[model samples]
Target: MASGKHRDNIKQQSKAAAKKSGNSIASRISNSFRNHQQVAVDSLDRLLASISGTLMIWIMIAIAMALPLFLLLFLQNLQQFGSDLDEASQISVFMNTTTEMPRLEQLRDELLGRSEIQNVEIISAETALQEFQASSGFGDILSGLDENPLPPVLLVTPLAQDAAVLQPLLASLQDYPEVDEVQFDLDWLQRLYGILNLAQRLTYMIGLLLALGVALVVGNTIKLAIENRRDEIVVVKLVGGTDAYVSRPFLYTGLWYGAGGGLIACVLILLAQLILQGPVSRLAGLYEGEFALVGLGISGFFMVLLLSAMLGWFGAWLSVLRHLRAIEPG
Candidate 1:
């Protein structure tokens, strides 16, 4: 009976101990969150006190981020424009002037049946002459001619725009008895591809370099902040403050700097887009095309903000890791 009573007491104690442990953990977590909130607020207040210097840092970061962002946007737009010109990649086949309509149709059908060709459009000599007359302001002169000089043309759009595919197709088309000329100016297309590739590489290189610059800029700023607060950090450590506690405010400072820079960069990009939109639209209109400048939408804006914040945090962490240890209570 005494053993049973002792066992019951032991179980109650065990339950009490477990409850106390859980409460302790919850308390620690809550205190940690509160401490972080206070540190962040203090850091922001300090930055607001030194508004001019903070603004300078933000401007530097903004410029660094904006250049690559603009280049990326330009490259995306250029790629879109290139895709829109898929029809321009077609091969033009001018048939013999004496070729009959039936033979022209037959050749078009044959080309369409091939796996390499996506589509074939045939223009009869009469239709071609009529289009030329309408555009060339030579209707009166053409009417005085003895007979139609234009030949029926076939526009063959290949499934692939690669030079290897196009070259063989051009040769085969030239071999046809009814085809008088086969024209595909591959050089310009190749040049465009090369230019796009070079631009993409340049954008990547510039972005990497600028990203490093941003991190360095934030690191330098954090270093200065640490130096200014050296006495305070030493006092905190002397009072048994942990390294993490001492570094928290500075880390928050770096985050604020990075976030502000990202916001400014976004605003700058938007302003530039607004200024350029009219001119770009006018240019597209001149080419008889409809195009609108695409800016960073909601998702992109949030992504930029998140990236900048992470960079700021990284820079702060790096600075704190390097310098916070060197500052001793003594």
Candidate 2:
């Protein structure tokens, strides 16, 4: 009888212990959820506590991001113009007025036979005179002249529009005795492309510097936050809070800072684009160009936000890791 009673008592204790364990697990989960929620609320409160200072930092970050973005957009537009110019590449070779007709014919045949020359159009002096008269609306002024002042010319298109190929061909053509002058219409295109390349490098350098600046800003802010909550951290440590628990709030704070700055930067970029769109469109129209100003579409918008958030998170993590170890229960 005693043995049976003892077995029953053990079973009862086992059931009670199981229930206690379950309650403990439930309590822990509830506490964790509450802590997370509180951390988020505190971070938001911190942001709201210093609205003016936060705005100033956000604006500084926005300007830093905007300058590079503007330069990149300018480079894009310049590249478009260079692409158009390249497709229409042509060299004008003007013959000496005294060059014989047979020599001119020989030169044209030679250019046509070369593999580098894609197409050639020969414009006679008389034909050029007639075109000028028709296009210039100066028929009356030209009718008084007895002789056409224009020289015979050849408009030559190359198989390659690159400077490497065209430059050599231009030099070779100038060596010809019948050639008076060779007008390279694409020199400015090369120059503009070179400038764009330099500008792209400058933009990259500037972006790197600004990214470092952002990291520094976030780190410093997180460090100050740590200092402000020093006693609370010490108390939490005394009560057996883990390092992860102590660091969560600061990490959230960094994320908030980064996200806010990214949003402001995007706003600045869009505003600048809006202000410049009309002028850019008008300028393109003047050149008969099919060009339009572009902005950070959906992909770019997400990218900016994601990058900023990562920077903020990393900065906060660094600060927390370095400083959390210094705070102890003692």
Score each candidate by Cα lDDT.
0.89, 0.84
- Candidate 2, residues 221-310, lDDT tens digits: the string is 889989999999999888878899999999988888887888888888888889998998899899888777778877888888888877
Task: Indicate the worst ten consecutive residues by lDDT in candidate 1.
Answer: 17-26
Model 1, CA-based lDDT: 0.89
Once superposed on the true structure, which residue ranges of model 1 sit more than 4 Å away at CA?
1-27, 79-87, 94-117, 122-154, 158-181, 238-242
Model 2 TM-score, all chains together: 0.65
Candidate 2, residue 226: the lDDT equals 95
Report residue 259 deviation for candidate 1 (angstroms): 1.3
Counting only residues 3 or more apart in sequence or on different chains, how many pairs clash (N, Cα, C under 3 Å) in candidate 1? 0
Report clashes for each candidate as comma-separated counts.
0, 0
lDDT of 1 by residue, 1-330 (tens): 999999999888967876877756677788799999999998999999999999999999899888999998888888777767755788889999999999988998999999999999999999999999999999999989999999999999999876677779899999998899998876676678679889999999998899888888899889988999999999999987988899999899989988989999999999999999999999999999988888999998998888887788888889999988899976
TM-score of each: 0.72, 0.65
- lDDT (Cα, 0-100) at 2 in candidate 1: 100
